[model samples]
Target: MKIIPAQEFEMKRESDYGTPEQNAAVKEIIQAVRREGDAALLRYTEQHDKIKLIAGSLRVQESELQAAYDQVEPSFVNAIRAAAERIRSYHQRQKRNSWMDLQPDGSILGQIIRPLQRVGVYVPGGKAAYPSSVLMNVIPAQVAGVPEIVMVTPPATGGTEGINPYILVAAAEAGVTEMYRVGGAQAIAALAYGTDSIAPVDKICGPGNIYVALAKREVYGAVNIDSIAGPSEIVVLADDTAEPSYVAADLLSQAEHDEMASAVLVTPSRQLAEAVAVEVERQLELLPRRDIARASIDSYGAAVVTASLDEAISIVNRLAPEHLEIMTQDPMEIMGSIENAGAIFLGPYSSEPVGDYFAGPNHIIPTNGTARFSSPVDLDDFIKKSSMIYYSKEALLRDGETIMELARREGFEGHARAIAIRLEQEQASQTGGNDHEL
Candidate 1:
């Protein structure tokens, strides 16, 4: 990590989002999968993942899922089960029910909340497996009452086993009803446009590599996506009281995630800044993924010295980081000032990994400054709401003129007549009753 003045470090866009070539490649992949269906999926699997597969083999079998349990240690299964339990418990609180309200005029208005009939969760496969992702993405949709949960991940390559056994075990533990052996942009397309073997889902939720992120953006309208997630990121808002080693370790946690991942520190103390920089350099040598972490720290990581902690927090809000740690003497005092960030950690005990692995909150947070306006994957993302209305004749009569005047003023005769005809018929029926009285 390098130390820079706050003014110099505030410059935006430290990383490249994507290239035109990548976008073009993604569009081509999406189109191919949509047209060729299962054939295209298999073709891409061989091309990208270095594995050739038949249509029948695209889906993982129930026996494979069961056998996955046997391959992994009992400890691994127990841990995944424990994590899934916590994740499910947290998300169940976010569940919502359909609501209705009735008025004295016999008119009813309400909202009907319904989970998506089907959903797809994409997990990155091959040598690297993240069982945590399976838990983070699947639990919310399940809690929302999704009927069918379909999972897709890349196949293994270079004579390696197909779909890491741990990922399969996690999916099984999460109660996934269906899964596939596929990856990258093609997998997203298969989810958006159904193939002979795989059916199209109402929404797709999960994270993947750059190609996966770009593909999600491409098929957004055809099928809903959780978010256009980018590389991992974290911003530590520290003070002199913050421990240098703790700050350095937390920053490296995200930097090690990918070469494009960013880890930043903003504090008012120059002494603390220098200490953390030294600590980060010393710790980098210990990381097995130090090459990736080194590239990230060299390119995107920074430690800025601000005039005051308030100024530092102001800069944090501008950056709108994905993860923010308030490692100060009193982390809570500064908590209220933070308006952005996908997840906020108060003290040193609430480290970033706590949320990433074991804690109840979803770790699939918004990244790349998207936290300014977007949110993490939650129960709301898996469900849809439809407004319900039942208007009685009396209620319509009471508000008919108000509606007609507004429509007529807008020069929409069709809209005004739709209301006027009904009111006129009711008035005529009332007049006939008066004639009988006379």
Candidate 2:
């Protein structure tokens, strides 16, 4: 990893990660899938994933899910169940309630919170199976009281048909009612537009590759999306007191995700930078994904030697990494000053994987500097809020003129007329006056 001075590194933009070709390819896939739904999905699956998916065989059955549970080792099943329990308990606390408030004049105003009737969760299954993604996506929707939760994954290759056993087990534990064996932009399209086999969802949530991200973007108006996720990233704001080995390990953790992943370190100590560089090189030798990690670190990762701790914090805030770790002498003192980050891990012990797995915090966070405006996935993602308003005759009479005046000021004559008509009816009902429908 290169160690640059903070001043020199400040000129970089985060969105420089993906090329225009990648974005254009994703857009074409999304448009094709939207234009041709199920047929397009099967064609893409066969071409991209090399898995032939029959229309009827797309949805996984309950019996198949149980068989998967039976096939997996008992110990791994137990772990999925335990993780599901923790995730469910944490998300249950995030559930919101509908409420309304009545004014003295009998006008009611508030928001009615309601969970989406159905939602779709996409879990990447090719090359790597993310059973954890299954748990993270489904548990929140269940806790939010969603009636139906559907999950989609790529069909297994090499005659090993069906979703991964761990994913099935996790889905069962997380209260997912339906499962589908489909992947890529086609899966996103299937969720966005109802297919003969798969039902459309209110919102789709989970991490995916570039194609999935672009598919979500294209189908955004048709269905709601959590956020347009980018490549994984981690920024560690460490001081001299932080252990070089621990910092190196955490940086490599995110680096191993993909070649596009970024792992950065910002500190005020030159000696610590050298130590971390050495440690990263030492650790890289043993990592299974060393080539990918090395590429990520070499391409996007860096260690910046800032002049002061304040300067380090400023650099981190500007970067707005998806994951920010404060491994300093007084982590708490510097934590509050950080205004942007998807998830903030305080102290040395709170590693990134802790949030990824057992920590109960959602790992599907905003990426590519989107933490400046977006937030982590939570119960709010599965629910929608509708503004509620009720007005009695007296309340309407009291506020009608104000409403009409404001509407008229905005050049909205129809809005003003609506309020005027209501006010006239309210006044007529109040006294023995002229009674006429406007």
Worst 10 residues of 2 by lDDT: 10-19
Clashing pairs in 2: none
User: Per-residue lDDT for 1-438 in model 2, tens only?
Assistant: 788988888523345424678767767777786677778778887888787877777777888878987878998878888887888788888878899998888889999999999899988864467788888888888888889988887777213655677778877778877888888878898898887778798999887776777778878999999887777899999999999999999999999988888999999999999899999999999999999999888888889999999999998898888999999999999988999999999998999999888788888898878889998889999889999988887877777889988998999999988988877776786797877655
- List per-prediction Cα lDDT, in the order shown: 0.89, 0.84
User: Model 2 off-target regions past 4 Å?
Assistant: 11-36, 157-162, 426-438
Clashes of each: 0, 0
**How displaced is residue 230 in candidate 2, in Å?**
0.8
Ten contiguous residues with the weakest lDDT in model 1: 429-438
* Pairs with steric clashes in candidate 1: none
> How well does candidate 2 score on lDDT at residue 364?
88
Candidate that would win on TM-score: 1
Q: What TM-score fits each model?
A: 0.96, 0.93
